[model samples]
Target: MSLKYAVLAALHEQPATGYDLTRNFRTRMANVWNASHQQIYRELAKMTEEGLLEVEEVPQESRPDRKLYRLSDAGTASLATWLAEPQGRPPTRDPLLVKLFGGDLVDPASLREEIERHRRNWQEELGRYQDIEAEYFSKPEQVPFRFRLQHLALRKGILAMEANLAWADEVAGVLKDELTSRP
Candidate 1:
């Protein structure tokens, strides 16, 4: 539900530096959750202070010291507690949906273009999910047990994106017909 839970879940996978977590957000959490580098680094510090994360500093020869983090027992407990609480899927508040609802006020053609743009973005996201699934999940035997757990979440994203793109197409068609039929 909270960013803290996501962070804990990630750290539970393996010990990682703040940079590593950020990279994971870009690739692994791209569909699920995305946090900026700054946000992640800040959360790491906060979690460390809260005793939910264990940090180990490793000296580097050329660069500054790196701090690797792992979930503490408290963090693990926290995550489990949160998980047991049956929270449904996250809600999305897209401004485009609002605009679409009142699209008659604007130029129909422009509104249709906006819907098309949103559809294109979702199409791109679906492609990314498909690519990741193919690259990492196709060979399930090679992946770790934890990765097998992730397959469902990844599949959920792929399905949601697909259904959304289909909905977008349907709405766009309606827009075209409605506009064209206007007296």
Candidate 2:
């Protein structure tokens, strides 16, 4: 999907300043989409001009005014329309996977080390997801109904991390065996 839809969906959650939206993209929406702060700010300006977002200027004592963004009527309709459309699985373009496809060109030991590093990164991400779940979703009944869907999305990220770890373990074992069997 387009960044426009992602921005609209984020604004739908609640009004936020550009900085707030960037923070959410880094943390809460990290699993679903990635966008730079510059890109988000640009989109906010574009959407505001397009009448998809309403901006409120809030003055600050020590800082410049904050432009708080909220989804306008048109934006809500736009988001709803996009949500109703069929979504295909996004194509995977992992850099590590692409590099591995040419693994014969590289030293096996070096490739294995890279794989281990990748595994470690995924492990860290899994911990973050688990922390979010424990902190916010531990008590299902306590969670507001509106947030249950978000919980479900987070679950997908957790499952993906778990699956990646398992796959990494299997591949690392194969690489280790290869290294040992080399005459």
Candidate 3:
């Protein structure tokens, strides 16, 4: 629901430094929620002050000390409570979709170009999700029961990317045959 909850979910997995959380966000969590490094670090500070996280500073010889954050029991309770509550679909705000709503007035060629770009992006995203799935979820038998939910979330991402690519293909085909062929 909030950045605070995302941070709590990350730390719920394991204790990690802010940098570690940022890396996780880039690699896997980005599928669910995207946050810049600065946003993450700032949220971590706020969470720390809110008593949702406990930080342990580990000093390094040549490098700066790293603050490893762990979820407090209160945070754990909060996370569990939040998970139990239902989440509503977020209000849509996709500019491309909004523009596509006016298909009769819009130029077909331009719309096709935009769809092509979106298809390319979805393809790239699918590749990344597939790589993660193969690397981690391939051998579900080997995974502990605790990680099943994580795999489930990853599956959702892969499916979403696949669906988006499929829709893009259909839209492009329609534009080429019907829309673009007209005056």
Model 2, 50-147: lDDT tens per residue?
Answer: 99999899999998998899999999998999999999998988999988788978778998999999899999999988888887789867778768
Clashes of each: 0, 0, 0
Candidate structures ordered by TM-score, highest first: 2, 3, 1
lDDT of 3 by residue, 44-63 (tens): 89888988889999999999
In terms of lDDT, which candidate is strongest? 2
TM-score of every prediction relative to native: 0.91, 0.95, 0.94
Worst 10 residues of 1 by lDDT: 25-34
The model with the greater TM-score, 1 or 2, is 2
Backbone clash pairs in model 2 (N, Cα, C under 3 Å; residues 3+ apart or in different chains), count: 0
**How far is each candidate from the true structure, as Cα RMSD in Å?**
1.8, 1.3, 1.4
Error of 2 at 76 (Å): 0.6
Report clash pairs, candidate 3: none
Quote the lDDT for 103 in model 1: 80
